[model samples]
Target: MRARTWRRIPPAARRLLAAASAVAAMALLAACGSDGDSASGGTAAVEPVTVGLASGGSRQDGSWTQAWYEGSQTAQAELGDTVKVTFVDETNSVDAYDKSAASFLSGGGDTWIFATAEVPQLVDKFAKQFPDSMVCGVEAPRESYAANICTLLPRFEQGTFLAGFLAGSMSETGHVGVVGAFDFPILTAELEGFVLGARYANPDIKISRTYIQSFSDPAKGRAAALAQMSQGADILFSGVDQATQGIYQAARTAPGTYVIPQYFDSWEQAPDVVLTSVIYNLQGVSQEMIRLAASGELANQHYEFDLKNDGVGKLAPFHELDSQVSDDVKSRLAEVEAQVISGEILVPGPDVLGTTGAGSKLDLATIKAE
Candidate 1:
């Protein structure tokens, strides 16, 4: 996942990449591998395809990394031994990350899916070095790439809107907390939409925002969640990947606190404390992308996902918290969903970050110290 790809993009430009389709694909090669193509109509030896999954953290990270793990598992299950999958975890170092991916490709892996955000920076290198192999970053930026490389981005702000609405409606302290691994463009969009959605339900909602600057430090996630709870946040969002486990711990210890998981369905982590989750349907995306590749059309065109697009961005099952979310709140959420799909609600992205709700800023000033 390229969590913070567009950090330098101006806020307005960020808006373009946020609330809309967000995925812009610039395909550079003529369609190859089409069924119509054959070597003089003679049958050639077919090379079997193998998928290699690489991540910066362990599968226990419970969010970004785990989501990709599940996606690959689903793909493997669907392929049923036709496609081989090799998984490598804990490759955060740039050199190690590069070597792992290259090793996979050199070891008969013809296709790759990278889970680390920074891995995409070397994508051009990978495409040039291993032209025969195509590479994809799970959540990557919008930049033109070789016909062998494609970046898929999800409009996550849509799901955060519904989560924010739930937080606002269920909060007992009128305060909600957002804790993230990094303040990347996508995460900024999530924060913006969260504030917008929360305030949409309760105009007086106060939000506390924090960025831990690391994706795998559980200690940081725990401390951040506790800090937010101490500041009167009854509903919190764990935007960190592996660190999210610590976030759930904080919410569990608190008497009446709720947490929202990111990138995957994490309600099973804390059945009662976790009210709902913003699920990124990467499993479905992986299946679709694989099909496209098999059909000779995987490269060039970028894939965009949001709630309105093939269930890319979605809310997980209500689980046991259906009663916790009142009928009015659920009804309002349904109505908001329609509005978001129709563009009636302009949930701010990174561009409109500082000021999101009723002229209030999504700054640390709102967080209480007590």
Candidate 2:
């Protein structure tokens, strides 16, 4: 009988096991059949590969999870009959992390397991337990793990810096705001980059930053955005997930106010007020990793995608206010972008917050430490 007790394990861990088994199964199947001819008949039968995606929240959360779902879809489409995709949601809890991962591994998935950075310990534990499984952890570093484990981290700081410059240029009141999901190290890094970029563009700029503490709380995000607007903020940048929609809603009622969307494109919400957006191209990365695993070329290393690889960057079409931004300003922004990509300009690290280094000047010590 097919084992069913493994269902109790987390989806992420289950995916790990499934991927390892699939790789082994494929190898065994290939060995049974001769290279030029099938062992039993003239035709060779190919088995469908199963891929499990373990997420920290619902797939429809309209933020990070949603972006991951898109990547999963892309992989499924590219792999066609060779792969079947399944998702296990963790529901934003520590217990859910292990449970979901374990469940995926036990479910008989062949390859491709995706996870968030919030549960690094859980991922490490599972990687050790299932050495053959291929795992990809998003937004975190992978350390001391099996050969099948990898990481997917983006250069969010680079994109946030560009957003800050856009906010600084668009703000008429010389004041801007950032509504963050949480004060985690990753989010803090984005905030630091945004504030620094704004001040670099305009020394007189005033930044009002606040954290909603929840990625899915639209009401709280709306309140935070409105509070900043009331305090003379003309441009609002969002680090919150779906809550960014709430900020856009508030910006619509008040004229001359702008907001930046996170992850995907939010241009449809407030075309006039939105200066630009920071988009993460998770689909491309997912597709590449999936292909690598299928071809037995999966590497046991942490892979970071940034402006250099087009993994993370800005997306603003320069809608209505395009004419307002001068050619000189655009030229300077382009130069900044080149410098950042070429390593001439380093986005300040997390330790520089609330100090003199918070401005245009970057602390070499912090950058070196990172």
Candidate 3:
């Protein structure tokens, strides 16, 4: 939901209020609720917890931010009054993100969830400043053990690789494309996995990759997608946020073109042209974090969701495009997925993919482009 009020209060005041809130929450532990019998063999009420969620784009972007927002909503629905989630959207800059944090702290928020890849460093800084608050950064470049800080990373590369395999098998032009929001390390790793999987499917496949430098700029995203299409790319992967709208529009104009979106299952957005989606189990991860915090088990550590756990990235079902894929392709995809889960085909992670910078780390020159 929209965080309407931004109260800029002094740090001392905020800390005092936070402490007061904690004490008040502790007092609520005694409230009786009609749930199943607990380990104490009596009725027990869930602990009251307030979570602050911040994202770099609109919460309804239908991609990265939307996925996390939906996750938080899922947790809120399941936990009922025991958990409260307040959120700020469009935090695309350092100042905006810090201001959102201050707003959350002023409101006595006990937990902080930064749902964008651009704000991990900011989350680290906030964690250091507010040692009492539990802060988490999703998709951090690497794991950290700092006090009061937790990082959640999903093996998104797995799904992207699978998406690439599908694109490779379906591309009649032998050329596919990828449009990313930024050249961040995590996204680079995902796109690289896509390229690798495409190559695996068709050794001579042409893959064109580009970044629009923003998660919300639809015009730029559209232009980038059109450029790739001009070069004969008939299948495209969208790694941006709301900008996916533009990519979908471009796909619609090109009759044979199709798209694969990440983070959310977006087939309905463009049912005709959408092949499948790379789904990151953000709902499960978000709920787990809330549960951990509520149970007082949250600690400074890294939580990774991946294929091995069946808790992270996986491909969505091919909706209307199901009939377009051959049975052999589907069979091969299944075999490849099993190999990936079995560790036989290891997808390179962020460590090998390189970090965020001005441009992508992948060597576009290494692969021939038509």
Query: Candidate 2 lDDT, tens digit per residue, 39-117?
Result: 4433556655666777766677655677777787888788887777776764578787677777777664555465565
Candidate 1, position 169, lDDT: 84
Candidate 3 local distance difference test against the native? 0.78
Q: After superposing candidate 1, which stretches have Cα over 4 Å from the reference?
A: 1-45, 80-82, 138-143, 346-370
Pairs clashing in candidate 1?
1-115, 1-117, 2-117, 11-351, 25-302, 27-300
Number of the candidate with higher lDDT, 1 or 2: 1
lDDT of 1 by residue, 1-370 (tens): 3657686778898898775543332221223433345453357655446777677777766666666677777777776645666777788788987898889888656777675556567766887778898887744345556778877766677788778888888898999988877655656667667776787778788889888988768799989999999999999977777777788788889867988887778888778788888887866765666655554566764677767776755778789987777888888888877877776665544445533242255442332122
lDDT of each: 0.72, 0.71, 0.78
Quality of model 1 by C-alpha lDDT: 0.72
**What's model 2's lDDT at 96?**
77
Instruction: Give all TM-scores, in the order shown.
Output: 0.76, 0.77, 0.80
Whole-structure CA lDDT of model 2: 0.71
What lDDT score goes with residue 288 in model 3? 80
Model 3 clash pairs are none
Models sorted by TM-score, best on top? 3, 2, 1
Off by over 4 Å in 3: 1-47, 140-144, 355-370
Measured by TM-score, the strongest candidate is 3
